[model samples]
Target: MIELGLPWVLATLPLPILAWRFLPRAKERRAGALRVPFFDEMIGSVRAGVLGRVKRFGAIAAMIGAWSAMVVAAAQPSWVGEPQSIPTQGRDLMLALDLSGSMAQQDFAVNDRPIDRLSIVKAVAKRFVEDREGDRLGLILFGSRAYLQTPLTTDRETVGQMLDEAELGLAGKETAIGDAIGLAVKRLGERTAEERVLVLLSDGASNAGVMDPIRAAEFARQAGIRIYTIGIGADTRAFGGLGLMSLGGGDSLDEETLRRVAETTGGNYFRATSTEGLIEVYRRIDELEPSEGRESHVRPMRALFHFPLGAAFVLSAMLVMAHVAGALGWNWTAGRGR
Candidate 1:
């Protein structure tokens, strides 16, 4: 589609014609007449001029056309492409995953097969990322310290890949729940008032890092960031030739701090004792903060002024050349007579 940015500039298109019709002419020169040596040749050349009324009319038409083109260019013409959907009320959500040394514990199981906590988290978190369409997603990995793997963006693939590639000791083996929440709050706080949310999954309490979990949660609440905390670890592990004994259980899990952090941000905390439980926790969180359907559209625009501006330039150049050629022809005629 074509549009004009400065349509009012087109009003100047008729100025030249109006001036020609109504503006007073300059007084004719009244200087002493000078004799020309080739007066007869000049007169003869004028009589044999190349253009008559048709040519004169053509020149006037060219002037008007060039002026119109110039005015059109000044009006700032543009070409707008097809409409594209953009999320207008989407949530700015951040996912903070635990990468502490404890995350390497073989507790969560998938399809009855044992897997480490981080591996299962990578699997489920990738799915969670996929489901969060139309929302800006980010990845934060924390062990002894928190690191923003990816900033807030609509590219879920990048965020998912970052989460999937995370390894233990990337930030250290000790869990830094406080650092993770603090980072999430800082990043989410930079976003607009549009729904801000964070999903933090960890297996241990704040055993490392400088900041305290409760203090970070308080900052998050003040910044209007809702955090859903998940404490992941099996309540017990199986032993060969022995009934399932108490091992890899929530013994190391800090449910109290996690619950307090979630509560401070007006969010909830969940304990994932199994792979199914972890998946269910995410599903429930999805239900709590569903992607908004509200959206808007905008068409990309490209400036088209150069077309008319180029035309005006070409036309004006042609007119100047024509006038120069006419003058040269008259000079040649007078030279021949000499």
Candidate 2:
């Protein structure tokens, strides 16, 4: 349906009449008047009949059409479609994932069967990303050295791919928790303080990085960046031996470093022992950082100038026909006076 954006502007429809009423007339020039020979004879035949009436009515109709065009322009008529809105307060988050060799440990249980830590983390983290519908999220995978696998972006699909493609020992055999945080901060430098966040998940401690984990956490705190840390490994008792020796029955994880990182940055630390625990951890994070924000928007408008433009062309064509038919310029006195 058609609608006017500024419907109040329709009140200006009487502007043309007001112009005709209040507009001042130009002063007549004081040029000397010239005498005409047949003025009296022209006055007698002035009542030309049908042609005269047609000329007068046609001129009035043309003026009315032009005025209608102006009124429509002022009212700003447009097509009304569905309304749209988007969140305005979501933060820019960077997911710093740990792909160290220990992440391959099948100590965590998923549906009563042992699963790798990386697999559990992947599933839970992907769900968390999906829940943050409006936030611009980025991915960074690290093991021994920290590197940005994927920069900050709004395309969650691409970030998910990068996360899925990450291998156990891609960055290295060891985890570089500090380097990952530093890399995330670098990428998040473009974002504002309130919008910047780093979420890091690791199954082991930082053992091989140029930057120290404590120092990195301090840097994040100084930069006003929040870091949510997750330790993704089960205790020794969480694993069981099936037939022979249990592989992950006696493995350990670095919870202290992860907790310190989170605390220093004014964020919380979570431990994911079982797959269910991982899901609950993600749910808690969601509650803490709810994806709610103020939304503001402008309604879109489409131009409709073509409708009046086509009418103007048709009117011009009619005026041309009238001139060509010799119906106009046949004033009663023109032939006699000339």
Candidate 3:
């Protein structure tokens, strides 16, 4: 539909008419004429007079049309598109995943084939991100150091893509859970207090960062940021036909520290021993949200003033050309009468 930014501008449309009706005409200025003083012309002068009057009427009509077009343009017409749902400012949730060398363990399976822990994380977390339509999501890949792969954004696809493309030992081997939590807190500090959240997942303990995991969780809690800790890795899995890779990967998972981090930040800690367990843990985390939250919407608008503005210009130009042509015709006729 078309809308006007300044509807009041249309009221000026009748101003020309009002002035023409109420105002007195200006006195005509006399000009030296090439008069034929010998004899007066009959049929031709009358014809020229009639043509002049017709031209005058045409000019008046064209002037009004141009004015109307200009007024419509001035009113600022716009074409508004259908309303689209805008995801309102929901939770500023950051997902911090471990990128240590241990995450490369092939203890998790997909379709009965063993896959690395990080692959399982990327798969399940991609699903989690898809379901969170209204929330802003971020990604942090931490090893010996923390790296914010994706900042807080409504573009969940970018976050998921970043997760999928992540490699092991990107920030060096050994988990830096504390640094990851600290970075999340820093990034989420500017957001609304009650809505800040961090979900940290690691297969092993925080053994390589400068900050202690427990202390970082306390700092996060103080900053009104809740942290959900996910400990992921299977306890056992058979590697090949020869024998089993005993104590597969879950041995290094520091459950006690993860639990303390979750408890300190008023959040929960979940243990995922397989791909299915990781999916279920994420499901449980999904149920912990405060609300679905509110959503706002807007229509895309395109300014259509230029269309009518161009029309106004064209009409004015045509009128000017017509007046010029009529003047030239009158001059030619006057000269021919000699």
Candidate 4:
């Protein structure tokens, strides 16, 4: 579709014609006239005969056409492409994962091979982040202190990469669940209400941080930020013969606090004992907090005023060249006659 940015400029299109019809002509200047023996013949050649009248009419038409082109250009014509899907009203979700010493425990398995908790998390969470089509995702890694590993962004691939590069005990050896929640709430509070969400996964209790987990959850609830808490680690030993050999030193997970935090923020709590369980938890969260259903669209526009502007310039240039050629012909004729 073609549209005009300044449609009112088209009102000036007929101004030139109106001025030409109604404006008083300039007084004839006798002093500027040059003495020539064939002055009458020259005048007749330009304005008297049928060909002369045709040339005069053509000049008027060219002037009108050029003026119209200029007016059209001033109107700012543009070509708007068809509307397409664009991200709007999508949820802004932040993933806060624990990087404490306990995350190094090889309790989770993938493809019949044992892997550490953080490794399984990176693999499963990376896939989850990649699947989020319209949601803006961020990453926060917390141990002794919470760190914004990646700010909220629409670039899911970059967020996933940052998660993959996270190392165990990089922040510290203790968990700061409260600090992680506080950071998420602080970052997501600035965004629109009802679209802010946080997914916090940890294997241990909050043994570090200045803020209390319950207090942070209350603040998040006030800010309209929903938090889904996941307590990850095996509750029982994989082998019955190996007594007292449970995952993560027999469940350091503070499940009660995690549940309260989730409840305070109008979210859910889940326990993941294996890689498959962890994946399932994330899948359920995905279903619970789905992307916005409201469809939004944007149209791409390209300015087309330059074509008309160029046309006007070319027509005006032709008029100037015609005047110059006529002046040169008259000079040559006058000199020859002399």
RMSD of each: 12.7, 10.7, 13.3, 12.7
lDDT of 3 by residue, 12-37 (tens): 99998899899999999999977666
lDDT score, candidate 3, position 30: 90
lDDT tens per residue, model 2, 53-116: 4476786687677667666766777776666775576778889888878888787786688888
| Worst 10 contiguous positions by lDDT, candidate 1 | 238-247
Error of 3 at 211 (Å): 0.5
Which residue pairs in candidate 4 have backbone atoms (N, alpha carbon, C) closer than 3 angstroms, thus clashing? none
Off by over 4 Å in 4: 1-83, 237-249, 293-338
How displaced is residue 261 in candidate 2, in Å? Answer: 1.1
How well does candidate 4 score on lDDT at residue 248? 38
lDDT of each: 0.85, 0.74, 0.83, 0.85
Model 1, residue 200: what's the lDDT? 95
Model 4 per-residue lDDT at 250: 48
Query: Can you tell me which runs of candidate 1 are displaced by over 4 Å?
Result: 1-86, 237-249, 293-338
Please write out the lDDT profile of model 1 over residues 135-193, one tens digit for every residue: 89999999988999999998889988898789988989898989999999999998885
lDDT of 3: 0.83
Would you list the rank order by lDDT, best first? 4, 1, 3, 2
Off by over 4 Å in 2: 1-87, 238-251, 293-338
lDDT of 2: 0.74
